[model samples]
Target: MPAGEVRLVFCNAPDRDCAERIARALVEQGLAACANLLPDCLSIYAWQGQVEHAHETPMLIKTTAVRLPEVIGLIQALHPYEVPEIIALPVTEGLPAYLQWVRGQTLPLDKSA
Candidate 1:
């Protein structure tokens, strides 16, 4: 894979509905090729100096690095949390064909220029 061509974006939502909505939006907008939502995760963290625990859905978004900014922006807009976690990790190694498919899926269908 080309350097920075692929990335795995991580985000957390308060509930399953929110996770599904966010994931669908991202994939529909071509910001992500796919999103795998993991539900019923217990997240324990500190916020505003208080320890908090909540059930969260963790979404793994697959997309290109080129589309990361737009992905983050969309997640921020749609997420309900005051500080939604959005992080991206570069995909250094993967099956070549799958990586290519991700690149292709993220491109706009209308290629006219």
Candidate 2:
């Protein structure tokens, strides 16, 4: 796979359960190749002109640029937050085989398969 073909999406959920739910949906729907839920994280951000802090579960989603839009849409539809955090970063370099696997996994499922 070439550079920029794969994306690493960053998202934060209210808790482990929420993160798991989102991760499962993304991978099951083929919008993401994998979703890694990290340990509890402390997030301090500005919202509505106020600074807020929360313990959250950080998620790392692996997918392709082609599936990014659908991935974002699904997260929004399932996320509880009024405005969820979803960021996609281009994969500039990685093990060739791993990147290829990511691409293949995210491809739209073939109905005839």
Candidate 3:
């Protein structure tokens, strides 16, 4: 595990459509190498000083630290909620090849600057 290199962002969507749209955007923008949709997620939380409950679609996004900000920003812009749940947690360890593949998949095609 490399310091400041891995990130696991957590975000939930009220509907499957929103989740899928976000997932497509993430992969297309190179913000995430892949997104696993967890359907039938039972979420219970408090909002606006009240208890809330709903079935949401959780998206498990796999990306690198460098692209996390961009990914979050995109989600925020498209997310319907007034305050979307977008948070990134660092990955302490992962498969070497898988991590490298994610990084490589998201890297800019043009290396020259």
Best by TM-score: 2
lDDT of 2 by residue, 36-82 (tens): 99999899999999999999999999999988989999999999999
Task: Go through the candidates in order and give the clash count of each.
Answer: 0, 0, 0
Candidate 3 regions exceeding 4 Å error are: 1-4, 108-113
Pairwise lDDT winner, candidates 2 and 3: 2
> Residue 107's C-alpha lDDT in candidate 1?
71
TM-score of 2: 0.92
Candidate 1: worst-modelled 10 consecutive residues by lDDT: 104-113
Compose the digit string of candidate 3's lDDT tens values, residues 1-113: 44238678889999999999999999998888888889668899999999999889998898888777788899998899889998888876888888888888777556675
Report the lDDT tens digits of candidate 1 across residue range 48-110.
Answer: 999999999999999987788889999999999999999999988999999998898787456
Q: Supply candidate 2's per-residue lDDT for 108.
A: 72
Model 1, runs deviating above 4 Å: 1-4, 108-112
Give the Å error, residue 35, model 2. Answer: 0.5
RMSD per model, one decimal? 2.2, 2.4, 2.3
